[model samples]
Target: MKTFACALAALAIVASAPAAFAEDRSSARKAQDNGTRQIPVCRKNLGTVAIIEPDNQWWREFNLGSPEAILRVFVQQSRCFTLVNRGRSLQNSAMERALAEQGELQGGSNIGKGQIKAADYFLQPDIVSTNNNSGGGGIGGVLGGVGGLFGHGVGAIAGGLNIKKGEANVTLSIVNSRTTVEEALTEGYARKSDVSFGAGGGGFFGGTFGGVGGGGYQNTQIGQIIVLAYLDAYTKLVSQLGGLPENASAAAPPAK
Candidate 1:
């Protein structure tokens, strides 16, 4: 009976091996092809919205593009708001209208004012802070200690593959366009301990999220961390607004 029980256990391990291998393969494919595959989606639109970038150019210091671009995609994917063009495309539109007024545009070109749609809400995305290397005790120290037992070469390679932790704080706010009153606010944070440098450095998404939130957010570890943080904030924002009663907005606390 003991022998039969051992046989059953061995068979269970063998049966699970292929399932584990298949899961690993699927995870690798998802990492390479679609890092944002799990982006939240909505069934209906809540309102027409425009993303407003802060006056400060902080994203530039991080090698990132306008935060509006990132928020634009999130809004579109979530289907929570109808996005409007308030960026450079609006300028181009104004230029086209100028040409129409000058008769430079072909006949029947109906470029004019009052055709633009009104925004019902404004979405503001902000990055509170980011730490690319956060945590106590360095990989170098661990490698040095291991080197005392292993050898100098092993320690050198380990040091070259040093991993660091990264974290970011982000926020998303929704405001009523007519009243200019803040309707809701959500904060998000993300931390990663798998960020590595030197020869062992490589991001998971590669080019998956590129051409949308700029190259940095899609390609670099710190940028990815920030994106994750923003995603968290956006998700929370949606959850906060999704199940609220219609009169919820009317119940805002009186200003102190």
Candidate 2:
């Protein structure tokens, strides 16, 4: 019976070898491909850190930033100092997960505790967020068909029948460890369809939202440049305060 159990154990090890090898290979590929991922360096040296997750249900799908824009991920203490992580969140999450599954985060946490390190942050940017528009009207087909009613019901019906869609803006915020250290508000406008950033610049969409108090998220028009540019300005504010810690492996030319 002892000999049989030993044989079974050996068989199990052999059976698991290929699966383990494949997992390791998968992790290695991820580590390589995700190397260029990063977040912005926080401008203010705060003791606490905060992160804002993108809400796809409202905001359009954004690939971080455009090719021209740059992203940097780092750590910092609120109202204190900022530190660039040797590993950005995207890449580190990969490494961290692998460690966690293998019980390595336990050791990391030990070292991380009381380590004078700040919290983590992510920054996604799109440099060339522009829009342009050409004006025209599409009343030809309807106008021709309405030739008979154009003199009568057309005027009254058209006045109240033109349907308009409203736009919404989203702002994401976070409070860490019972204290509000950081907040990131990403205000973006949504259209019925995807729009060219350059073409839609300087345009506004107005409509009503259905909610109580006759007060819903209204007057929602955020310019592409103004929204993204606000990030740049905020980042600078954190940096000048010397809130982030230094990261030796930090990339100078963020991934294109």
TM-score of each: 0.67, 0.27
lDDT measured at residue 217 in model 1 versus the true structure, 0 to 100: 70
TM-score of 1: 0.67
> In model 1, where do residues sit more than 4 Å from their true spots?
1-26, 32-34, 134-165, 194-204, 213-215, 243-256
- The stretch of ten residues in a row with the least summed lDDT in candidate 1 is 1-10
Top candidate on lDDT is 1
- lDDT (C-alpha, whole model) for all candidates: 0.59, 0.29
Local error of candidate 1 at residue 86 (angstroms): 0.6
Worst 10 residues of 2 by lDDT: 1-10
Q: Candidate 1 on 1-256: residue-level lDDT in tens? A: 0001111111111111234555666544534323443345655567678898865555665567776767776777656678988889999999998898888998788888789887777888865555555343433433333344335655444444324546666778998776787878987776664333231223233433545744467666677667667777876677666543333234445545
* RMSD (Å) per prediction: 14.2, 23.0
